[model samples]
Target chain A: MHRIVAFFLKQYPFFLFLLLEIVAISLVINHNNYHKGVLRLGVSEVSGTTYEIWSHITGYFSLHQQNRALAEENARLRSQMPDAFKASDRKVFVRDDTVYQQQFEYVSARVVKSSVNRQRNILMIDKGVNQGIAQNMGVMGSDGIVGVVQSVSANYALVLPVINVGANIFARLKSNDQKGIVSWNGASYHYAQMKGIPGHILVEQGDTIITSGQSVFFPEGLCVGFVTDYVQSPGDNFYTIRLRLGVDFNSLNHVYVIRNLMADEQHNLLKENGDAE
Target chain B: MQNSPMLHIGRFAALGFTQILVLNNVQFGGYLNPYIYILFILLLPLRTPPLVMILSGFAMGMFIDLFTGMMGLHTAATLFVAFYRKRIMKVVIGVREEDYLGTPGIRDLGPWRFFYYAGAATLTHHLLVYMLEVFTFINFWSVMLRTLANSMVSVVFIMVAMVLFERRRHG
Candidate 1:
């Protein structure tokens, strides 16, 4: 026993190195839960502020492109405005009476930080709980869905983007109501895989995919991706469909956090029914 | 001497910010991210105590992890680099312990030795990082490709940094 103690004393540094590495590895292995740890909260608060400042400086470099995209979006929105339409003739009375109400509210946020290379990529946005951003809120870019809010701080929120392996988006083919789930294969940020479409279904290249609106997180018809290719092995029941994502994750700048106004009601009703989670 | 604690702190801060602010945002072909921040561990004094080396590596990696929101990936990889740093230096430098009294810079070890050491360390660090990231052997070849690509890019950048900064023989 004394000789063993001597050996350990002589090799204490190596053992310490191993111990530290084990601690770090455990943190990585349990990273999903580590999001709620104190270290994450503290570090995010510090790093979030730093990233915000850095982004502000770098944000100037892309102003021309940003303005062009914003202008195009403004034009599209203007065309949809009621004023852009001519009034029809003869005695058409429209009754508004409780037929439609605001279902989703959008909170625009600037992406101060993001990464696309990692398997589990995350984006930090400049808005957070103070701006009504909450966990599970759907984030959308101008062109397509961006990600879902994973965690929220006072002034910043972390988004688990669609490119991340952890994110699974329920999507529907635009040509038909055929539904499938979109998931990242951790290979490339520009492409993802869609599963659950039967092999018998006719899937063509360039078929658009959009959010199904079945979940309370996102409204329906948001662009997801376009089918690029698909394959089915012999005797396989499903086709492995490839998708080219709509959002350019590398240059994501601004996004909208969607708050489902009726989320609580829907969740409560579903919980009462004991059929949906 | 260039081995002052203040210089080390400055280097750490500078590299950390550069990595978080700039390198992390720069992706080559949408996947290759050159993690040059491990240069802190690579540039540490040859005779630094193992404990100091390991802890410093952990701190540098944690600095990045904090910004990237990846709590453990960088930490584990950097710690691995730190643990094997001395051995890699020994293998590349091939000199007696008392012969070297400072950090392993291009001037101290010559360009080739420094390159070999940095390349080996970066390769090992990236191997572990990508392995833990995918956390599976299903895409083993792809992981190896990522490791090689990232390491090559990182070594090139490290060599450029050495040529630009490590000119004097202080410490």
Candidate 2:
């Protein structure tokens, strides 16, 4: 303690010098706007940067909750899209009766399990019959079509995404009215084949393909992909077109299960026609 | 030798008033204001304690800042000069034991030695004052120019004041 006291007494001048300098600097910063602005900016910048780092650190721990919230928000927004309505014209018109009827509803679900490299890729979502998720409903992501619900349990549902070999979606060219059936051939997750486009349809390399409303699973104009390449062989009846799949399967997270209100009516009509014939 | 505290206090009041009233208004060509108040720090007795010297420097600077509103620039520069005055004295007059005991004036140390000692201190004070006033090195050359021009006039005024007041001691 004695030696420590002596050491401090020897360094008293330096301590005094520092104290006086601090006083002077505070006075300068307090009185001068320019110095005050610079000091405030430096202090806030340091603190703001530290706060951002802390937020990122805490953010990693709550990723599951954040993903759930995001999925719910996406579902709410997807249900409001024009394609979710059955009306062809979007213009608002006042009528005695309701002019627009909601034809589609969406339930938010998370992909709890998935695979891409397999021939029969399947996705399991966290929502099942408890969340109104039923089999054969269309599942779409924010970017494009994902798949149809294959089966459901009490709290989980299985999905067959577009990359699966058994999956097929009726897709049409956006530029022209040419329609084709999109399917996977167990080759690559990035590419899918669109079959039955006739040869003289003037297909281009970059034509955007979207879902045709004729199918009950997916709504009209739901994006499938852009035509990366297309070729027609001699005496062939149709064009062999390859498409870059819109939804990236490797990073699939949240999906919306589209519930078509008219699906039962359409299917019953078709079944009755088949039985009569 | 130590001067009486009353005498130093009187000097402080007189010099501070004159600086705020007369010399501060004596700006020529908007660049040539003389700061003669620094002489308080320069003319302090060599035997004065370093702490007293530094505090007196700060008080005198704060007094001037109150009137001129330059806000801490004068205090910082004056404190700097006061802190380094002992080293400057040793450099001007050799490190003799008796040299530390005398007052610094043209009579105690010859005119040339005193001039050099006071001139260096005044130049340092002026450079610091102007640099702190500008607060940035973007106008470094102009700050240097102003410091040199102002220091020349201030040194001349200080020397003339010294000769006038201490002429009897010189004889």
Question: Which DockQ value does candidate 1 get?
Answer: 0.80
Per-residue lDDT of model 1, residues A1-277, tens digit only? 9999999999998898888888888888777552453456556778889888888899999999989988998999899998897778536846484997889999999998888898888888999778888888999999999988888888888888999887889999999889999999898899999999998899999999999998888999999999999999788899899999999998889899999999999989999999676
TM-score of each: 0.95, 0.44
Q: Where does candidate 1 clash, by residue pair?
A: none
Per-residue lDDT of candidate 2, residues A92-124 (tens digit): 634443667778898877765555643455666
In candidate 1 chain A, where is summed lDDT lowest over 10 consecutive residues? A32-41
Runs of candidate 1 with Cα error greater than 4 angstroms are A1-6, A33-39, A89-97, B92-95, B169-171
Residue A49: error of model 2 in Å? Answer: 47
Candidate 1 chain B has its poorest 10 consecutive residues by lDDT at B91-100
Candidate 2, clashing residue pairs? none
Which stretches of model 2 miss by more than 4 angstroms?
A34-277, B92-95
- At residue A138, candidate 1 shows an lDDT of 96
Per prediction, the TM-score for chain B is 0.94, 0.93
